[model samples]
Each structure stands twice: as structure tokens, then as C-alpha cells.
Target: MDAFGDGNFEQSEIDPAAEFLAREQNALAGLEDEIPPLPTGPVDDDVTQPKAEDGNDDFSGYTVPKQVTEEPERIRKWREEQKTRLEEKDREEERKKEELREQARKELEDWYKHHEEAISKTKAANRESAKNAEKQFVAETDEIEPGTEWERIAKLCDFNPKTNKSSKDISRMRSIILQLKQNPISTNKKV
Candidate 1:
């Protein structure tokens, strides 16, 4: 416990470092109060003005004379004539393009009408060829051979030949399941 004014501490004491810091802070405040005040000067804008000789008023170069309007009128008339000619040329080009487009459309329609039978004949020929290819493929590979593939599968999976009874061939899914179960994992997995 500590007293506020002219009192003594009974239980707790102020730390020496804390007391020294408090005294140092008070001493710094006293020093600051004793220092002289700083002087102030005027701002820069009050002492400076822009000069005309520095080229700020450069409108004198762009000031148009009385005769300037006359020459521009002549140039404007000339440009108007040129613009008219260009517009006429554009209309002519558009008309020519329209005629050419019509001619191309007529030619395409005539060609389609004239060669319609030929197009149908070619498509039918292609369809017939595809059907023949499919028939040849079916004839060649309709039955599985009894040698290598059948023999290996017979040895591995179902091998009861004396009674003449065995399970059907393994399906695609069954083959994948067997391969996954038999092949070891770890580094044996395909890279």
C-alpha cells in the first residue's frame, strides 16, 4: 500500500528501475519546456509569379488570320467532291458484288440439280462396299481357333477334358480381375 500526498508505503515498495525511469522522464520534460521556440518563414507561392517570357501563353502560334477561313472553304469543297466520287464507286462495287453473288447461286443450284443422281449412286456404292467388308471380316473371324489361346486358357482356368465339361471362356471383365489379383503391386505396377 502507498499513500498519495506526503504518505509512506506500508507493504509494497516502488521498483528502483521504475523510479529512475520516472525521474528521467520528468527531467526530459523539464528540458523540453526550457528550450527556445522555432522560427517560421513564409511559403514559396507568395514570392513567385509566372513569367510571360517562359512560353506559357503559346496561343499566338495558333491564332488564325482572317484569310485562313477562305482556304479551308476551298479545301472543304474539294474534299466533298472526292467523297461523292468515292460513294458512287462504293455503290457500283456493291451492285457488281450482288450480281456476282446471284450468278454463283444460280450456278450452284444448277450443278446440284444436274448431278443429284450421281451423288446418290456414289453413296450407294460406298454403302455396298462397307457391307461387303463387314461380311468378309465376319467370315474370317467368326470362330475362335483351338490352338494357342484356347490351350493356354484351358491349362490356367478350367481343365476338365476327360468328362468333356468346362466353364465358358473368361469374359473381358473377369480377365481384368484375374490379372489385377495375380500381378503384384508396388514396383511391379506399370510405370
Candidate 2:
């Protein structure tokens, strides 16, 4: 029928340009149909009134209350109360610190007392051990005779064997022999 070879092109009576123009006219007419007119009345004063103390706090009416300040006496009283509260808090902290210091002092005293007792016990034990050692030394030296090692040690320690009797000689000889044993090199050189 035409260059595209479509048979409906010849039979159809639809004009695309005319159809598009008709749809545009219909849409434009719908947009203009029955638009509401703009308001023309005076605004009511009640809607713009400020809030009253009667509890109607809607945003349609907003009001700012006056700024109020306390009296000088009331402010002074409040400051005093705040100071008292702070002082009480400080006193409480100080009391706790004092209690801690007292506890620490008591603990230190206990430790010192225990240490003193331990030192006293140790000194007593050491004295007992020394006495036992001296007795044992005397007992050991009691068996020595004229030409023995104890006699030689006694002579070396500036003690005369002739003048010293058995009871006195034994203790003196034991001390001298102990000294000689402690310093063997010096005693050996002397001998």
C-alpha cells in the first residue's frame, strides 16, 4: 500500500498529529476546572493572642513570660546552704582519712611489738647457746693434760699452766684453744 507495505496504512482514518492535539486540549481543560478562590477575610485577633495562665498553650498563640530574679536574702541563704553541704562533705572525707591513719598506726604498733618480742627471744636463745657452748668447751678441756694441744694453746694465749688449777685452767684453756682454732694460720706461725 505504501513504501512500508502495510495494508492498514491505507484503510486507517487516524491522523497522529490531530489525535495528539486533542489529548493535549483535554488535559489543559481538566487543570482549569473549578480551582478554589484565594481567601479574602481579615485574620482573627483571638488566633494571634498571647498565651494566658489558663493552660491553653497551643502554638497558635505564643507568649514569653517575664524573667524573674531571686531576692538578695534568699540568694545569700542558698549560698550558705551550698557552703554547708560542701563543708560537710569535706569533714566526712577528713574523718575517713583520719580513721585510715589510725588503723595504719595501730598496724605499725603491732608490727613493732611483734618484732621486739622476736628480738628478745632471739637474744635469749643466743645467750643460752653461748652458755651451752662454754660449758661444752669446759667439759672438753677438762680431760687435757701436761703436754697436750690444749696446754700448748693455753701457753700460746699468754696463760701459765703452772699457776692455773684444774677448774679455772679448763675454762681459760678452752677460750685460748677456741681463739687458736679460729686463727689457725697465726697460731701455727707462733707455734
lDDT of 2 by residue, 105-159 (tens): 9999999999999999999999999999789878868976534664445554644
Per-model TM values vs. the true structure:
0.28, 0.36
- Model 2 bad stretches (over 4 Å): 1-78, 146-191
Per-residue error for 180 in candidate 2, Å, reads: 11
Please give the TM-score that candidate 1 achieves against the real structure: 0.28
Residues 66-140, candidate 1: write the lDDT tens digits.
332345887989999999999999999999999999999999999998799789999999999999978975775
Clashing pairs in 2: none
Most TM-score-accurate candidate: 2
Per-model CA lDDT versus the true structure: 0.64, 0.70
> Worst lDDT window (10 residues) for model 1?
60-69
